[model samples]
Target: MEDRKQALVSRLLQYALIHEVLGIPYNEIVIKRTFEGKPYLECSKVGVEFPNFNFNVSHHGDYVAIASEPLCLVGVDVVCCTEPEKEPVPEFIENFSSYFSSLEWDNIINTGTSDEILVDFYRYWCLKEAFVKAVGSGLAYGVDKVEFHHTNWTNISVKVDGEPLTEWRFWLFKLPERHWVAVARGHPRFATENYKRTICKAEFDAEEYHKGLNLPNVAFVTRIIEQLIPVSHGEERPTMQDICSDCLHLSSREA
Candidate 1:
């Protein structure tokens, strides 16, 4: 019952946000999931033609987040910090060192506190997950192949196999309740290839994607459950959005 409720609410959030963004009726909105479970909006039928208009959702601990882009493929991830009780922090994190690059691993261990170390580990993990998800790959991605470089989790960049991927963008936030959230945006070619194998492929142009200079920044907006609930009688309400229109909008509430 709990799982079903969670699933139902997730659908409600997805549909509500899609409706808000596309300004179209729910009947006309078509969201098809990849075999890997990444939900994408089918904008062609509605005459909305953004080459890589896509979104991704993630939930952890006490929050659910959705990140969308009109030109770039977007992915988001949230993780609650948890410290291991039995194993030493270094030993516990070392076991998963293969998932991170040497530089990333070094930074993760160089932290001063055990708590900081754990947070650092989760931060990188979340970033990697967001990047892969944006690229249309699931968590079972070549995570170690790409490394993130950041300053206090902002002004971030990434390198794949020691070469900078200049087109990619990333943002991170320390959410309420000690959770870390990461958002990633990148080219649609890498995103559409893996997910569209079993579905209707999205039409994306590299030039148009790169030409899309105005990407949205990440926003952690607080919303009530009532807002996510659909209104009856076909009534309508004013749309509430963040200032950075094209970025990720994350709504977090107590579970």
Candidate 2:
């Protein structure tokens, strides 16, 4: 399992190669940890080189995920559903209630469907997590301080203990049995006009991963990457298939 996890991390780094090839310096690369233990990559140089090129990555259990854009401040998380914790709701609310508005909680509790409630509950959790993750504070930032736009779920307005972050967007989606994913970017704009180019750019090519896996399993990794990326991106964001397909095509030509 350790070997597999390490291999997964290596495979995951290949996605970063796109940045490197674009003349983003490796020595200048910066990765930092938050007070609550979230990891953030610092691309001060990359940000300058391609102001529109924003990216973030998260991995959990069997999945590895990444998000990149021509320009945007972004954060992403991948959480596996195959290992749902057995924690109770009241306890969860008790610990995190300060984060939810009364209306939000009311909407959650009053909603009749169990799945809807569960999904909503997770929606808040993952969104908050993504926000803190975006700013590099992780869970140390109070969930209550970060408020989300109710209508679109993309806009975020933060009231942290010290200061406020002006505007940002939060997005959350499910990735089948493997995980739930979340993203935060420094834009309130969720319109698809800018997204068409981003989806075209952010992708993973599994052939690199294939070098270390069995032939049959190589196809499985490719399939999983294809299936999950689009779900995470949805209609508004670029699907993983679009990016990965481009990557594979490029690799084939070079070969």
Instruction: Give the number of the best model, judged by lDDT.
Output: 1
Tell me the whole-model lDDT of each prediction, alpha carbons only.
0.70, 0.47
Please give the distance, in angstroms, between residue 224's alpha carbon in candidate 2 and its true position after superposition. Answer: 6.5
User: Tens digits of per-residue lDDT for model 2 on 1-255?
Assistant: 243442344233534444343554333334443333333344444443344454555556555666544444456666554323576554544565767766567766666655556566667666676665554455555666565556545443544443655545455666767357777665413223333233222222454222211211111122343332222212243333423332322210010
| Positional deviation of residue 38's Cα in model 1 after best superposition, in angstroms | 1.3
Clashes of each: 2, 5
Q: Give every collision pair in model 1.
A: 216-246, 216-247
lDDT of 2 at 172: 65
RMSD of each: 6.7, 14.6
Candidate 2 lDDT? 0.47
Q: Which stretches of candidate 1 lie over 4 Å from their true place?
A: 1-5, 196-207, 211-213, 233-255
Tens-place lDDT per residue, model 1, 122-195, is 99988998998887777567889889998877789999899999878888888877888888877655764656
